[model samples]
Target: MPGSSLALLISPRHKVIHHDGREVPDPTKNKAVMKELGKWWALLKDKRFFLLVPVMVGFNWNGTYLGIYLTRYFSVRARALGALSSGVAATAANIVWGYVYDIKAISRPTLAKSTWVIFSVIMLTLFSW
Candidate 1:
């Protein structure tokens, strides 16, 4: 039921035709409808949304890699402590990021571009070690 409801909500618009080919519904009239639907689809289809997927994967991988590497290099207790510390560090970082976003002094696109650079640097650092 939920899946069907989701599908109904997300289904794309279809053009209908009149019988006898006399006249059909104007497509320009449907532009508003399509635009509304596109807003929902853009959650996944938009370039910005898709770009974040790989960044999230890389961030998670970095955290996991750091945890496992620390464990192997040190002891299990040390690894656990390191992981806990990393979690706290991530939370603090997120808090700072949220504050910047809430302040709204800069546009979102500017923030996103800066964040892309920061994410790239983080990934490079993670992979270099």
Candidate 2:
């Protein structure tokens, strides 16, 4: 199949690095298995991943409920349209929020306070409806 065969033509020209500043070993080359495992273990021990557990769980739970609601209340075509619109809206929101959050001129404390205010307003508006 063309889909399966197309992947064979692609190759990474550069070395990959882990988030914790470790270089990822190329699978094509022989390396020590225990050293690689140690790197992975170090990454697993990072506190940041654990901190995101609740957020990850909530996202998945919300998505599951959204899927159920869509299927229950919408026709096939309407469901597809709703999914596309939701995806586009989410992307646009992320882009706008990224721009707001990345404003380098704003002091971190000011930005954090503004973000909290905006978030609170949005959440209150949403929950009030």
Best lDDT among the predictions, by candidate number? 1
lDDT of each: 0.77, 0.75
Residues 13-123 of candidate 2 have per-residue lDDT tens digits of: 354555698765567786889998998999889975564555455557668877998999989999999889999999999999899888889988788767666655654
Please give the distance, in angstroms, between residue 28's alpha carbon in candidate 2 and its true position after superposition.
8.5
User: In candidate 1, what are the lDDT values of residues 36-114, reduced to their tens digit?
Assistant: 8888897777777777776888978977876677867998788778778878998999999889887768999889898
Error of 2 at 71 (Å): 1.0
Window of ten residues with lowest summed lDDT in model 1: 9-18
TM-score of each: 0.58, 0.54
Q: Which ranges in model 1 have alpha carbons more than 4 Å from their true place?
A: 1-42
Give the Cα-based TM-score of candidate 1 against the true structure.
0.58
Clash count per candidate: 0, 0
The candidate maximizing TM-score is 1
